[model samples]
Each structure stands twice: as structure tokens, then as C-alpha cells.
Target: MATVVLPRSLVALFPGAEHRVEVGEVGSVSGAIDALEARWPGLRDRLVEAGPSIREYINVFVDGEPAALTTPVPPRATVHVLPAVAGG
Candidate 1:
């Protein structure tokens, strides 16, 4: 299983959302999102867009490296979901 670290913003939207969730064998980031969506309805909407791509304001990292939906998720890898920040 891979460990997925949820963004605080996202966690706040879903009551009872865990900061870290363990997802079963998922081939790619998309699969992991699907697994999470199964647990928390509407979660995928916050992370991905219509094209099934990561949302413009969201960033996903696999093992601390930037990644996309197709990025491979090795077993026991750590996936981080973050929202982009901006300020003037």
C-alpha cells in the first residue's frame, strides 16, 4: 500500500478525512485518487479536472518528486497532495 498525505485544505472539506491514508496497490496516481474517491465522495473533484488531470491549483508529488496522474506509484511510496499558493 502507498501512503497518501492529504492537503489540509482538502482534509477540511471532508470531515473525518485523515492526514495520511494507506491505499492498496495502485499502478498510478489516478488509481490512488480513485481509491481515495471511493472512501470520500467528491474528493476526486477537488484534485482532478474533467480531463482526469490534476487541477490547476493542485500539485501532486510522488516520493517528493513532482508527478502527474500517470506517474507510477511504487508499493510503500509516499504521495503528497498540495494546493498551490499565491501572494502578491
Candidate 2:
């Protein structure tokens, strides 16, 4: 999980409504989605895209650094995905 630590601002987005996450494997985002979906069925549709590419305003991080949207999943990495905040 590369010691995943959630940013304080984005706590409520997680389905768990508890701890954020620590996705250790990048390729396993789908796997994680599946797992989370099992727990909270609504989560899969809310999080993952039905086809390809994650939804907009969402960013993933690896190793405490920004992971490009085009970057393929890395092995044994850390991923933190959160929605972009905006107010106008």
C-alpha cells in the first residue's frame, strides 16, 4: 500500500465512510472496485467507468506522487483516488 495516508479533506468520498484506502497495486484498481462493490454495491458504478478510462475530476497517486491518468498500473504501488473539489 506504500503507506497510504488519506488527505484530510476527502474523507467522505469513500464508501466505507471510515478509512480512505491504500491500494497497493495499480492494476488492481478494478479488483479493489470489485471488492468495494461487494461491500457497497453502489460503489462500482460510482467509482469505475463501465468501459474504459476512469471518470473525470478523479486523480490517482502512486508512491505519494501524482500518477498520470495515462500511466499504466504499476506493481506493488500506492494509489489514492479522489474527486476534484470546486465551488463557484
Candidate 3:
């Protein structure tokens, strides 16, 4: 199982949202997302678009390295879901 960490900003969208989620036995990042979506219905929709691609404003990391949805998620790896930051 891999650990998926959610940014504080995203937590607001759900009731009783946890800062971290455990996705069991998932192979790809998308699978891990499916696991999360199984637990929280609307979560995946917020992270991905119609083509099942990750939204441009969002970023996902696997084990501290920047990764895309196709990135493999090994067992026990950490997946961080963060919003892209913008500054003036």
C-alpha cells in the first residue's frame, strides 16, 4: 500500500477529510487515485480531467519526486498531492 498525502486546501472539499490516505496494492498513480476515489467519491474528479489526465493546476509526487499519473507507485511509496503555486 502507498500513502497519499493531501494538501490542506483540498481537504476543504470533503467532509471528514484526512490529511493522509492509504491506497492498498495499487500499481500506477491512477490506480492509487482510484483507490482514493473508492473511499472518497469526488476526490479523483477534483484531481483529474475528462481525458483522465491530471489537471494542470495540480501536481503529484511519488516518494518526494515529481511524477505524472502514469508514474508507477511502488508499495509503501509516498504520494503527495499538491496544488501548483502562483505568485506575483
Residue-wise lDDT of candidate 3 within 1-88, one digit each (tens)? 7899999888888888789988877998999889888888999999999887999999999999998889999999999999999989
- TM-scores for all predictions: 0.95, 0.53, 0.93
The regions of model 1 sitting more than 4 angstroms off are none
Clashes of each: 0, 0, 0
Give the 10-residue window scoring lowest on summed lDDT in candidate 3. 16-25
Error of 2 at 59 (Å): 1.2
Q: Tell me the TM-score of model 3.
A: 0.93
What's the true lDDT of residue 9 in model 2?
A: 44
Judged by lDDT relative to the true structure, which candidate is superior, 2 or 3?
3
- The TM-score, computed over Cα atoms with residue i paired to residue i, of candidate 1 is 0.95
Q: Which parts of model 2 have CA positions greater than 4 angstroms off?
A: 1-16, 22-27, 65-76, 85-88
Q: CA lDDT of 58 in candidate 3?
A: 97
* C-alpha root-mean-square deviation, candidate 1: 0.8
How close to the true structure is residue 15 of candidate 3, measured as C-alpha lDDT?
A: 84
Residue 14 displacement (Å), model 2: 7.1
Candidate 1 Cα lDDT to native? 0.94
The clash number for model 3 is: 0
Model 2 worst lDDT window (10 residues): 1-10
